[model samples]
Target: MSKEILTTKDLHLYYGDKEALKGINLNFDAKGITALIGPSGCGKSTYLRTLNRMNDLIPNVTITGTIKFKGQDLYAPSADTVQIRKEIGMVFQQPNPFPFSIYDNVIYGLRIAGEKDKEKLDAVVEKSLRQAAVWDEVKDHLHESALALSGGQQQRVCIARVLAVSPEIILLDEPTSALDPVSSSQIETTLLNLRHDYTIITVTHNLQQASRIADRTAFFMNGELVEVDQTKNIFMNPAEKQTEDYISGRFG
Candidate 1:
């Protein structure tokens, strides 16, 4: 059986008086991809942020219950939020590469962490770009400005940047929503190859994409987890009528 790397028990979150996430319980497997699917503002993204305590940055935000990483409480007062984020990196919907050279963008995190060894940084940059499936195309232009790259290439560079930090888990929030179909496919392919090394949780509004790439799918609606199961089962034989309705496009 795959190891359970992260888990939540009755997890809840609020922004001031508005509840964003109701009680959410989930167990995420190591080195696997789990997709969160729901309509906009249904709490899928909110829950994803909770995994790495990203919600803590918001003022007046309140969280309750337990989020555990390898059986350790993630919300503990003494828990290191910075460390959690380093281990669980996030890639957003739009590509947001820094206005730096391609090589510099990939090694940005390492530099912040005080790594000064050029040889080691070079090795990590190469490995990360290779893993993100964008090495060959940009290898000759490593010193070129990252902003000059196409949207898809920039997104892959962001992925490489995350990989260089050696994150154990990757959180993607509608990562392909802004890209063209071909670019989206490339990102999906890269993610598939990456599942052997990192746990990935992606929140997507695209139902078909979830079916195509997710090993397991969790359906959320109105701040609640409707159901979670194998991708095939969730798509072909959902246990809840609400899930079936949403999947069939009856309602979102």
Candidate 2:
């Protein structure tokens, strides 16, 4: 069994007075891909954002629970939200790169963190692009505006930017939902390879994509986690009736 990197203990989230997450307790495996699947508006995205306190950006969004990273409470008063986000990187449903040169886009985070060393920035930019599998393709055009890249390449650049930050975990919220098939496949391959270095938690509505890359699958419904198990078991022999119904095309 792999080590548990992050654990959510009865997580509850609320947007204003409306509850979004209902006491979720789940352990994310270190160096493995855990896919969260469910119908639309099932709180998969909400749960993903809570890992790094992204929900805190919204006013009146209340979170009541302990999220532990390596057994340390992440919601503690002393816990640094910025550092937590750095350690737990996130990719959104849409490819959103900074409107700057490709190189600048990847180095933006470093610049914000007050890194002024040019040589170090250049080296990390090259290395992270390669890690994201787009270095060779974009090396000659690093100065080009990031927005000029194709949607898939832009998404890859976003990945490179996150990789450059050296996060221990990557949280993806339907990352491939906006890409073409080829681009989506490339990102999938990149994600598969990234698992060797970081734990991945993804919320994808695409059942096929979840089946392809997830080592374990979690089913959520109406803000509740219904079932979680290995990919094979979840798809072939789910322990819960709702899981079976969802997987067999009966319902979301």
Candidate 3:
């Protein structure tokens, strides 16, 4: 059995008077891809942010419940948010690479952490780009502005930036939603290859993408998890009628 890397119990969140997440309970395996799918405003993205305390950035936001990472309480008063974020990095929906050179973008985190060794930074940049499957395309253009690359390449570079930090888990929020089919496919392939090394959790609107790359799938509706199971079972033999209906295009 796979070890549980992250777990949530009765997790709840509110933005002022309105509730966003309603007692979410889920566990992520140490290694593999888990996709969160649902209609717009279903709280998948909000829940994803909660895992790394991203929601803390918003005013009037409040969270209640236990979120544990590696058996340590992520919400504990003593928990270090910066270290948590470093260990559980996030890739946003858009390919928001910094306006810096590709090499600088990939090394930004390390530099911020006080790493100044030229050799180590060079090695990490190359290794991360390779792991993100965009090394060959960007190797010759390492000094070029990241924005100069195509959307797909920029997204991959962003992924490399996250990998350079050597996070134990990666959170992707609709990562391929802004890309073309070809670009999306490339991102999917990169994710598939990364699953063996990192625990990945992604929010996606494309059911096909979820089925193709996710080892497990969780369906959410009205801020509540409708069902979660193996990808095959979730698509072929879901236990919930709502899940079946959504998967069959009946309703979201």
lDDT against the true structure, per candidate, is 0.94, 0.93, 0.96
lDDT of 1 at 180: 94
TM-score between candidate 2 and the true structure: 0.97
For each candidate, what TM-score against the reference?
Answer: 0.98, 0.97, 0.98
lDDT score of residue 222 within candidate 3? 90
Report per-prediction Cα RMSD to one decimal.
1.1, 1.3, 1.0
Question: Model 2: per-residue lDDT, tens digit, 1-252?
Answer: 248899998999998888899999999878989999999999999999999889888899999989999887998999999899899999998999999999999998898999999999999999999989899889999999999999999999999999998999999999999999999999998899898899999999889999999999999999999999998899999999999999999986
Candidate 1: residue 53 lDDT (0-100): 85
lDDT agreement of model 2 with the native? 0.93
Q: Candidate 2: deviation at residue 6, Å?
A: 0.3
- Candidate ordering by TM-score (highest first): 3, 1, 2
Clashes per prediction?
0, 0, 0
**2 or 3: which has the higher lDDT?**
3
lDDT of 1 by residue, 1-252 (tens): 249999899988999999999999888989889999988899999999999888877899999999888878999989999999999999989999999999999999999999999999999999999999999989999999999999999999999999999999999989999999999999999999998899999999999999999999999999999999999999999999999999999977
Please provide, for model 3 over 224-245, each residue's C-alpha lDDT reduced to its tens digit, 9 standing for 90 to 100.
9989999999999999999999
| Residue 156 CA displacement from its true place in model 3, Å | 0.6
For model 3, which pairs clash?
Answer: none
